[model samples]
Target chain A: MNPLLSSIFSTGFAFAILRVMTPLLFPALGVAVSELAGSVNIALEGIMLISAFFGVIVSAFTGSLFLALIAGLAAGILMGALLAYFHLKMKADIILGAIALNMFAAGMTIFLLFLFTGDKGSTSSLQSLVFPEIDIPLLKSIPVIGEIFSGHNVLTYVSLLAVPFFYVLMFKTPLGLRIRAVGQNPHAAESVGINVDRIKLYALMLSGMFGAFGGLYLSMGYVSWFSRDMTAGRGFIAIAAATLGGNMPVGILLSSLLFGFVNSIAIYIASLNVPSELIQMIPYLVTLIALAVFAIRAQRKRDKVGEVLEHFDPEAVKAVVKDVIETEGDI
Target chain B: MEKFILKYFTLIRTLIAILVGIIISVVLIYIISDMPAYSVRQFLLGPLLSRGRFANVIENASPMIFCGVAIAIAFQAKQFNIGAEGALFLSAAVGTAFAVSTGMPTVLHIILVLLVAGATGAIWGFIPGILKAKWGASELVASLMMNYIAYFGGLYIINSHFRDKDAGFLVSLRLPETAWLPQFMPGTRLHLGIFLAFIFAFLGYYFLYHTTSGYEIRTTGNNQKFARFSGINVVKVVILAQVLSGMIAGIGGMTEIMGIHRRFNWQMSPGYGWDGVIVAIIGRNHPILIIFAAFFLSYLRVGGQILNLMADVPSELVLVIQSVIIILITAEAFLSTWKNKITIKEAERVEVANESVAQ
Candidate 1:
């Protein structure tokens, strides 16, 4: 390959990663909010799965990408509400509810595939609305940054925009404080006049929006069509990213971008001289390693803090123990 | 008498949950599809109309019982081992691999395959266990990620190394007949896996409720600090739960393959581990209750298939219904009030009786 072409290829590879990571980012954000609120949204994978299908089907039928996006969002909220209802109201286990949603999504999507396109593994025949490209005229004039950021899918930009919004929601707003409070100490929040369950519900709803956007991107922006398990392990990757990023918006965006970068490289490598199977495993493998590293570091931090607090701050230790006890009683 | 009353109360509440679930399923079918009465009947009574189909229900329930109990065991230990799916997939592949490669006596070969499968699953589950124990990693995320690796990893192995060239499908070669699990019912799809599932559930009950280790595991699950205060090795207990849970899930995969498919294949499991997780919760991590929960789920599967054959209704409706049921049950609203009511009634009755005795 020519030197210039090789450089361009690498750049394109980098762009592909960005494209891939965009879909993963939103759901990860959703997972972050819900997890922070002490409600583990395991159904994110299922939500994305159904929403991807609905995004294409509704878009193709109506010839409106916006409508399809709305429909997808509705579908995600439905799943999220269903999950929250069971988890918060009916007292169902979070993981179990998620599992049911996953199974439901898997089967329903396949069934609908047969109902709509008569295909089991894919939905390629649908003339779905593709998200328009956002070309920043002024930004394009910039030298290095222009090429990197310009001419992307509309949802890609939205995903980027969501990061700051999530940060503000999680830290700046009363709702965000309530969500964090509910997650950290639900009883304390309850004592402070916060309805812990209600906070969780709101957090889950916000999460559904993020998850729905993820699904919309998969169908309308990333691929123009939906395939079975198309979001693949991205939902789980998002969960990993959420944890790796320490459940913060800025950290999540960076983690998601890094994952996207890894994904793009993996795709590029697979296109070249590489075994497709091994290449396929690359993204998941990276997630595993990244998560492991993040976890180890977090554990070390917790241990060090505990050690310092144990001797230096007896009152703080007592307060922490009391907080844990209160939380334990509530659970 | 107390045991009988407790069992009956459990049964009654379960039945009510099922009934409520049925009503919801009917409503969904009515809205999504067309027929109301027929679909409702099919959803409710479709599983018991035939012998073969009924057996199919039990057969499907078999692995779920294994996975559910396995999950329940871990849940009791307070270890969230979500890699039951991964464990099942990897173990199935290992079981099939051993069956093909090893030439031994019939009994030994079968036993060896099961053992190897269990070990593979245990190891797969053990990685996250060790991570959570030593590194403070979240098992939920780790196990979820590992599930994908194990799933596609098994697929890669089967497609590359064990691909049965003669078979057109993406599957491995058939195992030797000697390694096949015996059928529980002749001329039916049901196999000895059902018996094993029952044994595992009973054994799970005994192990969890009766053993010293079980007490330690339960304490560890209930509260780590408390367990630590009691001098229990919480980390070891949690890790053990994961490993043991994985072992059962591995055997679940083995029983599934050895009893049903006879070879490794892509789509080895259709979210059995996930279903097991739900079943575990619905059963409240109790062993015997898991049996009923598994049966209830299998009824839906078998009944859904029946509905598909008999009516124009899509069988995916069952999945939707099952999901709704699980969601409703887990939502906490449906059960919490009932729990509160029952608890309150018991308290009132006790106070009245004490007053009467004092008088």
Candidate 2:
């Protein structure tokens, strides 16, 4: 009944989906980079919050967008260093440490926010700068596709471009190969004189960098100011994106886009007089259903004795999908 | 002496972590405040400055114990469930609805509300448990996702079905006097819920250490495949443990609502579930230790709040310090390094004994 639902048929909807996907894509890419190296970053949510806070406060004080950006990224890397110190050096349980780091980020950012501007809920008092959306010169004159692609925040283009960049960095480079080797067989990699801890350190730091970009994009690009707990579990959603995508760069991009579409739908539904609370549940419910389907398909693969494939097999996947649909129909 | 020290090594490490956490927090206090000494005094002794303040610590720990025990039970079953927050909110809402809408004998009404909370919580938890058991879904994400759903769903329920017309807020109809938890202290907010929390902790300890089902849950947690090979119903144990965990969290939230507010309110459970995780980790997932950990955390919170009120320091500072303590306490490196030192010393002692025997 909502008029906004009709927008789904227009190019505006496509543009909105793309815009929504940009923030998720950056973190999902980071998750893919780290998880493929066998060190999952559960602190993405915390890292994002820290960066968003620092991005605004630092920009307010320095009055330089570049320096603020660097400071924000540094805050995320600092999270990685803390994780590495507790998880690697102190030998803490990695997930537990990550969770604690998240809490620390949540609390520290608010504490610092109060210190900077006497605001506990948000950084509305600060006059922080945001990145300008670039209208591509040649692309602006293109057909329907241009409307969906042009006039996005600078980070949006960078995020889409980083998909291929990550693909090559992960699949084509020696460091990538070494990271995979260390992950798959630490003993073997160590015997070959590859420093395992050093590689893990490198992976964590890189993961932190990309994770911070996603966070910085949220505060400095998506919104003009920072808000308390503004990440709203997007970091976890990014992990879901990475897992659904099988930790591949291209897969991450597509899955993030899929999630973006769902998120857009959730927003559109909000206009239909549905309570805002129920509307908020849509994005999460969609994620749960998608993950359930993924799990069921993985189970089916095990039953068929076709060990889980690294990439999609069209015929096999179609058969599985048909079988699931038929079984549900029967029930 | 050596045996005793070795037996309590984990405890010693946790104590050290807590001391370090406090010291770092004090240093931060010094940096943030002009009256460093006064700030430190408030942070340390503010909770005990008066009976009312000390009672605040007890009141805060009541719900914490509920959530802490909930997390401890689930963790012991090898299910990394973080859905207790959702379970708490939904269960409390359901319980409060039943309490406010229905009238019965006072004691019977309370019993019914508790049962409603526990049952609703179990259903909430069982969904993800069943998904994980049947389809191999990652319960962690499934449960985390479930929390958001529960949060929004609970809020919707309050807004549509239970809203108090004259209250002017999103809160629900207040429970009748029959549902109110009796206060032992006439003037304070301290209710029998604090005692109930202690009871839950003690029962949890007993259930974990003494029961056959507990052994099954523990084995499943330690190694699911091994437990299956040993004839334990691994799937059933996993689901059941989570159900029980949810029941505890539900009771916790209901207790807080009935005992503290006596009204249906749907706000998320004060991050008690997340705090539950930190306390459980600090307690090493032992039920008895979780009680102590909950006490310590709530004490820190009350003290921190007093400091926030007295000085310009934010109470959120305790969260930072709490995270530091948890990370340090759970670090396995200290245990491993200590074990290595003990092994080396034992080897030397054996060699010396061999030399003496030869002589």
Candidate 3:
């Protein structure tokens, strides 16, 4: 077999893909939740960093895994609330506020790290509580396929669980319906007595919760250590993955896996005869091309929307709405 | 006087926001430090106590002013281009590579190097802008993604072509003497690039206010549908603004390479791009005001560095202060509404008294 085919079929490579994709899945889900609610929280980068630092800090001092996890998620929620307060209460632009928060997170984490450990780098001095890996009852005993799927970090399974959890919450719950209604047609939703701002805030909170989970996984589950600015644009990579995936649960998983596979390949190819710089550029170049392709696809989709919009019957829509309103009144 | 106040409302509000930011920082310093009063005093008036420190502030502000102008220009056109960081690195690498590898007359060589750098940057920035104009891509995401690409691409070039094997570090070879920007003073690090930054700021102001193109860009930004209705090519404006923004950032990168290091260095960006975002916002996207904003930010940076060296303090306190100020200032409904409410109450009272006197 050729080297390319051999690499593709490698068992170790498959494991690396899942390991890398685990951290990304949470943030990708978070991005989906926020985008579904009409507010893009660009502060995922900062939120993950701050939460990761705090998670490790709490895990080290308390030596309690569960409390550290809660602290991480709480830190993310606090950042999310700050964004909501600025955008909702203070009337700051969401994008700009997010950028500010990101800068603050970068500076604050390092500053606090310095104060706590007296080290300007990674928090390696303190021993952090680790989230142990799990081996499936029957899967680990099987052949290569079982080896690929089992014996992963506990958070990997949590990330997998979150996808179904989000799918249900997004499509099967009343709050999810309200969020979708507000995101799609805010004026119509508001006219029906739905509180738009509250829904958006709740959506942002959920998004923050997912982001915090990702942060906790990075520090506590993935590697059991915290480093300054360790996320290293992984949050951005999550954004790219979410965007590429079309912001759906299944799509996000596939996209995360794709990017993770690409990332693993990038690492694998580093041992080749080519320059390391070229090796590093592989993932980013793919990301840029993917962006262009996504943009093109969206453009084509929008043009189709115009033709569909032209066929709208105003009177028929009014009758349908009236019938629904009459049924609601009867209820 | 009333018209003047209306004209400078953003400036006045910014000042108040900055004052509030400083007060909060003082409290933070008090909490974090053993000697709060001394630290606060040093933070406020530290740069002036030494000539070198003051020069350090000016030197640092040079790149900020250039990048700030670039951001302000892009923001004025509503492009929201955040790829200036990548554009800065790529253009400088291109400029320095050209300068070092070429053999030409002094002036022409420098001019060519600069032009190449600006064009590189403009092309680098135009990708996202054109994509947004033509296909309605999210400019923010496209620009940010482009940043990572540019960063890695620049590093690739530096390592492959410009590696100075004798430098004991992964940096580029020194450029020809023709490309080195002259120092403003014998001993200080301040160089001729600062004047270029000042000129660009003036150009930025003039470009936004005086030209017909400026009017078109602003109109397009303010209301795209209205601009289309008024026969302005909204798409072209969007693309052009980002192109210009990238070009300016690229030049800033080139100047930074020539002015400070006199060599092509591949050091990680000191985050001048992010700093420019705050500076542009603090200046309300105005040119002359951005110069002041950049200098003020640099002063705080120098003060923070001084404290870091003097008392083992982290320089990140400056960043916290900057983020708070940007957040508050950008929150128009936060402090401005209160200011307007007070002004309105005073006006109502005065009008009531005048009516009673007339009766």
Candidate with the larger DockQ of 2 and 3: 3
Q: Interface RMSD for each candidate model? A: 3.0, 2.0, 1.6
Cα lDDT of model 3 by residue, B74-162, tens digit: 88888888888988988998888888899788778778888999999999879988999988888887888788778878877887788
Q: Supply candidate 3's per-residue lDDT for A140.
A: 89
Q: Where does the lowest 10-residue lDDT sum fall in candidate 1 chain A?
A: A322-331
Report the TM-score of the second chain of model 3 against its true counterpart: 0.95
For every model in order, the fraction of real contacts preserved is: 0.68, 0.76, 0.66
RMSD of each: 5.0, 5.1, 4.3
Question: Which tens-of-lDDT digit does each residue in A56-106 have in candidate 3?
Answer: 999899989888988999999889888888898889989889888987898
For residues B1-359, could you state the per-residue lDDT of candidate 2 as single tens digits? 44555677788889888999999899888877778899899999999999899889889888888888899888998888989999998888888888888999999988888999999999988988888887888788788888878888888888778889899776899998898778889678999998888999999988888999888888888999999999998889889888988999999999999998888765554688887898888788888898888889999999989988998788888989988898878778766777678767767877899999999
Worst 10 residues of 3 chain A by lDDT: A322-331
Model 3 clashing residue pairs (backbone): none
DockQ of each: 0.47, 0.56, 0.59
Choose 1 or 3, whichever is better by lDDT: 3
Task: Write model 2 residue lDDT over A2-32, tens digit each, in one string.
Answer: 4775688788999989888988998888777
If chain B of candidate 1 is superposed on the true chain B, what is its TM-score?
A: 0.92
Model 3: DockQ vs. true structure: 0.59
When just chain B is superposed on the true chain B, each candidate scores a TM-score of 0.92, 0.96, 0.95
Report how far off residue A298 is in candidate 2 (Å).
2.0
Candidate 2 has a DockQ of 0.56
